[model samples]
Target chain A: MNLTVERVSAGYGHVRVLDELSWRIPPGVTGLLGPNGAGKTTLLHLLAGITRPWQGAITARDGSASVLSTGKEYSRRVGFLPQHFTFAEEMRVLDTATYAAWVNGVPKRDCPAAAWAALEQVDLHSKSRDRVKSLSGGQRQRLGLATALAHEPDLLILDEPTVGLDPAQRLRLREAITSIGARRTVVISTHLIEDVTYMCDRVGVLAAGKMAFDDTIDELAKLVDEDAGHGFGSAFEQAYAGIVARLGREA
Target chain B: MTDTAREGHSVEQVLPRAPKSTAPRTGFFWPLGVWYFLAAFVVIAGVTLVRTSLELSFAYEEWAHTNGLFQRSALDITGPLAAAFGAYLSGRLTPPSRPYALPRFARSKAEFLAHHLLPAATVVTAGYVLGLVPIVVKTYSTATTGSLAPLGFVIGIVILNTLLVLGWLFGVVAQSAFAAPIAFAAGFAATLCGYGIGAWNSVTPVVGDVSTAGRVETLAFALFRGAFFAIVLVAALATAAGVLRTRGFQRRLPPVRVFAWWILPAVLLAVGMVRPPSPAVREVNPPKICKEAVGMSFCVHQAHERDLDDLVAEVEPIVVLVGQENLPFTRVEDTALHDGANPHLDPTVYYADVSPRYGATGDRDIIANLIAGSETCFVRPGWEQSAPGYNAFMLTLRLSGDRESGADKRFGKLSDKQVHQWLNSHRNQIRGCAITDDLLP
Candidate 1:
């Protein structure tokens, strides 16, 4: 997926969040690292075509010039896992996945197999029939992941995907993302530097709705090397801190 | 790829897999708990109210004959209440504070409304039908006494259910736990106040008349009430659908667009209130049906055509007694159906305005009034006009007539010819109460 966002600006009422922000997401695992209230979720929402940008456009030039419009056709190509997501508690895990696929324009004849396979990827295959409310916190998160992947979207965006997961659950989710990364673009937005170090090939850091750094993981590591006095905490955190320091000084 | 190639392509390869199970689960996806509750409440409450009303009046025979129960019970709070509850719960299916799921299944505002609104409307309509079960059952078993006004009943039901749907639509628009009660209140208020005001007083919430079974006003009221409700319901639903489709609440539609919807119903109500349709007047020519009976020609309206022969037979004896004395009026006409609207104004013709049970009994006041010319002015029991001399004349006639088992003693004392001569001379006093006369010689 070759997705281009051109100078998109959005806000709620008088409080501006994303202002003339632009980025291009290539086919790989990309991580968007930002602190709370850094407009990471809003960016993901814009990409998922849930909210309209006040200015500028987001477009995907794949086989067709499919613009990110607020409609079913646009939604079908993009799968989004919101920062805070929930489904009907009475809905079974498999049914939840199936519903997601069905809404994404998957035919009924294909929904079962697609839902089942999505569940397998998320390692919730054994509990497909269990009610979503009955699941553990980690399992519920995994169920959301399975639903997002049910339609095999070209661009899969997960906002704070590992916010409430245990280490083991986080590891399981990382494996699923790593496995799916080759065929489509996976965008994960979170505050944790470790998530970027563990899962992503490319990383972008946002500070106050503006991009502080956008490069490969190795290029981000170069920032840590330039700040030699930042004594080896995690190299990733050191790099993140250096970028934040540089942006702060410039502001 | 060929159709078969596409059909056979494994979606499993693209998605994850579930663990082995003996059977794949498949059943209905419709959520039913709140829906069932709403349907049951509407049906039970509506039917119970109708049944209780019929029992209280001992009017089921009449109700069943004219489909009066259905007419009166067609529009009520039950349907609106159920719709509000069901719609409020449906929003819980995908809470609005959170993202809505059905939008994923739809592309536009119209499509979105179709996807979600259809199910809600279906549940409400089903509730309406279930509520009508009692009336429908009663109708099938009971024989119709006169020509049935079924069109009125149908219009009533349609208007009622439309209001219920409007209630549901409002709940959908509100999209909160409190939405149900708020929607119910608004709906109940609109209908209750509509009826409370004189403008729609004749229209029942169930969509027809609440009283009087046999009059043409019942049908006229149904059509008028139905039209008004139908127009209002459309406006409400249109606004509701528009609100639901909007991405956020508190956003206002353009002023001109608001006018687009509000104007139609407002104008319709204005026109209806300004010039309501009068009840259709069906003039039944009484003179055409006049039949000679008991020294006078008696005629009744077409509705009471069947009772004419029996009525003629019932009055012939009284006429014979009257002819034995002297007579003034030669015609005794019944104006029951018209409720005295079309009375023979000729003083020579005696007319009785009283309701009666068919094949049972005629009003005794008519027979006495024929001799006494006393009009039964229906008023509150406390405000009755007392014509003492006329009352005395009726008492004299009844005592001396075959109604009592005594001899005509007043006539016996005075010879029959002499008694007749005295009464004829004193006819002015008896008929007009213009003068006082001695009761006893």
Candidate 2:
């Protein structure tokens, strides 16, 4: 799966958040790193196809087939887990997953099974009958994952998916992402450098509503040398800090 | 290095049932309790007013009477209340969290609209239905007597829905929760202005005249008014949907096209205003359905065809009393003498005011009073000269054998026959506008 965004400009009312932003994401787990208002979520929203860009276009292709050309079909191939995944508090985990499947055009008769399978993939099948409000923070985050993955979309976009998770849950999410990324594209937006080092093969850094870097971990690490005495952190973290600092200086 | 990353490969391989991709469903919560509360308030208020007022019997007379009650309740209370509250609620319908944003994988806008409006309309309708219970009770209550007209109730529901949709559309257009008070004010002001223009008056669901067989005409008018409301409702819904799609879903606001949809309703409204039906259309008598009793013809409006026999029965004894007086003529008409335009009215005709404040078609006391020359109009509003009028009126009662009061004792020892003779001699004055006993010599 390949997703392309070109000169995309989107905003809320008069405040423009994503201005002439452009980037290309290929089939793999790509960690989207940015500061708070860096438009990472906006870009993800654009990719999810829920919100439209004021200017420019986004096109997605699965091999030779145009996924973005037909909306419902494209929607079937793109999964989006929003920054704050909101569902009815009283809804059962299974029902929430089923609803996600149904909205994505899973046939009514097949929704239950599809939801079950998606929950099982997220290790949430055991708690499928629990109300969303009753679930722990980590459990809810997993449920969010299950909801997004229920329809088995080809391009999964998760916005700060593990924001409130404990270390164990974060590890669990990293594993889930890696497993899903093997056969499809996964874009995880976050501020955590560890996520990218642990789960992603490639990293895309966004700064000031624009993409500053899009390259493999090895290529990014090449930006900083070990003898430079940059930091005591890992090589990937040193390189990431260097790239972001360089981008800040340039801006 | 991470244990989770190593488990990822296995988690994926073990559970291949997961979809490669999926989007979130629209999880917006419908405000059911608010609607229920609104409905309850309207119903309670309507019931209280009707119960406290003494005008219940007239509502049972026919569709017109019931319509009169609905018109009063809706215009005086429910319409403005519903519009204001509905506007406030709709203004808060969309927030950043629940954008009311169009779903990525929905079948069509119709389906989307259904998902949005079905629950909303249901809640609103439920509230409206709750408000109508008092009306139903009034229709069947002792003071009122009639079978509830489903068509009348349906029209009431449509009117309410139109008001609610208009308020909601206003809120959606405003696009801010803070605009709720403004929306409420605007809705109230707009409807009030519409009322002032008199263009909206005919849209009131009052059945003005039901004595005639004008059901076809009333129904036709009802349908016309309904169509007018339907057009407005559809226009508002389309406009809101257009906004939601362009701004939230499509992210490209098509201002011109979205606004253009309103022209349909505007044109229809203009047509309605320009060619609105007259109040006379509702007030016009139905075809005459007459019955004879006590050697006199008792004719009523055609809508009262079903009640002619009962009316005749009520008037029979009165007619007999009037006959015994040997008056020149003895015809009693069922007309209410509204603005004095009854075609059947003549010098000999005795007009019964069967309005809510006065007579009822089936009330024996009122029918007897009408027959015994009940004097409803007096020159002044005081009890000072009330005795003379009461004495004059009591003479008729004595002659008719309906009742004998103290004033009858003041007849100066005259028998019922003599009192009848005296009233017969002064029949012209008695039937005249200023009813008096000046010719008592």
Candidate 3:
């Protein structure tokens, strides 16, 4: 299912994070790029149903239900991997996945198979019997992804899922996300522009809690001046810098 | 290189998929901490049993009833230890971000709380229940009258669960590095306070001296106390849920539903405080177990039937001596069968205050105390120096087989026949506490 954020405002205590932020996410890999303290995680939290919007609403594109009104139903269809997460270390990998599926409303009888499918998709099925504590950092990230995927949710929201991974682990994770994006909507919030260029079909740059740039990768590249640089990295960097600079000017 | 090999095989050529097992895949994996708690419970329970056994060795009367053993084993020390472990487990399980994490899941608030809290609660509760096993076995071996006191055990369990719930709430609220220690202290204090209250006997698993005849614990009073603790358990859970729901959010009073949960407990508490139940022990007239020996009949409470043989062996010789001497009393009875409100002053029957702590020698002391006459009389300050009732004292020492190193030398020695003759003449006066220096030989 696609999601639409309409004129939403949210924050922690006295600090306003998102201000009248509006964005549409279609069913494909959509990358959210933002600088530090730019409200990327807060926006993801709102989408994941972990936090409530102070004003406006988040709803399915067909207007069937709003996240605020249909919380359990919405949560059942959406899986969220927080930026920082921990698991019960003593639990087996498959058991952790199965528990996640059961918690997301999967039938108890189907949980094991669903967990296996999710594990196979992430290429972590070989390590399913190992204790969670025995996993390395990248394997744990994949296990988190497997937990999110075990319930076969329609929308998977991952916040900085590849933040601390090595380049090889990042590429493997990006490949997994690319294959999973074929059949589901995946929203990835990250600081890496390469993640968007390599895997995302569409990208949104969040600046000062507002969507400063939202378009296809080609369009974003076009916004970069030809005199600036050569490769995709330079062009994307130039484009992101331009958006932040423009947001600064507006502020 | 063949033509069929060059093309892909048909879809039906693959092996058939295995049938899905359909069995529930959620294998419960208890955290290492739960195992640790279980081990700790075993060690603590063993230590408690050994300590209690040693204490009871000197006071066998205390171990003669199942209810007493249940109280000493289940609540006296294990209850507080269970609460502390419960708090530590909950604190370790729930981090500060749990409240933020739980709301994102599809489970209801109650389901989530149960999933998080039940494991720790179960381990603690199961530990409490298992701790009662050795005590029950020990009591079963010797106790003769009262069976297990169900009402008292139920009250103990309710009180224990209430402590656990309170500890769980403390851990949930104080999700910090020091939460475990603070929760442990708070849990221990809470259970101790429950024990400290005046209604402790009502809540405790002690059915006071059910082995004694004419005594029983009132079920209604015990039920009321159990109900109070059950209400506290519910209220604590509701409070914990409320705290979890509002944590990390803007601070405000709990929602109406949370307050609604407390209404019943509050009403019950007020009613209970206003007019509480009466004393738990009540009077009952159970049939006495009797045995005849040496021409004198001996009777005791049914709970003391196991002690009758030993009692008879120790007192039969004394009874034969008294019979030979033609003493006024012809029968010995257990004091437990006596009605304290209305004294039965039959001169033919002597009442003996017996306990399981009394061995053969201790039983002999009972007869000596009776023959020595009443010591509560208002006598002169120098009565002992004057050797008042010296004949009676010598007769008692002879009956009890006690050494006479401190006997008065001023009074002349008397044989058993002379003492018996003096006792026959002054039996009524001795019973009435009328002994004087003039009564001595």
lDDT per residue for candidate 2 within B127-211, as digits (tens), equals 5565555555655553322355566567656766676677666666675545546655655565555446555554433333332
Candidate 3, clashing residue pairs? none
Quote model 1's TM-score: 0.71
Q: lDDT tens digits, residues A110-220, model 3? A: 567667777878888878778889999999999989888876777889988898999999988999999889888899998888888998999999999899988898899
Question: What's the DockQ for every one of the candidates?
Answer: 0.24, 0.17, 0.24
Ranking 2 against 3 by DockQ, winner:
3
Error of 3 at A167 (Å): 3.2
Residue ranges of candidate 2 with Cα displaced over 4 Å: A6-22, A50-57, A68-73, A166-172, A218-239, B1-106, B114-220, B249-252, B279-289, B301-329, B336-345, B353-377, B381-415, B421-441
lDDT of each: 0.61, 0.61, 0.66
Worst 10 residues of 2 chain A by lDDT: A102-111
Model 3 CAPRI rating: acceptable
The 10 consecutive residues of candidate 3 chain A with the worst lDDT sum are A61-70
Candidate 2 on A1-251: residue-level lDDT in tens? 88888889987787788889888889989989987787787788788888878898888875686656236566667777877745556556777777666555555445566677778777888787677789888888888787787666778888888788899989887887788788788999987888988888888988877788988877776787677655678776677777777888998
True contacts kept of 1: 0.22
Better of 1 and 2 by TM-score: 1
- The per-prediction CA RMSD against the true structure, in angstroms, equals 7.0, 7.9, 7.3
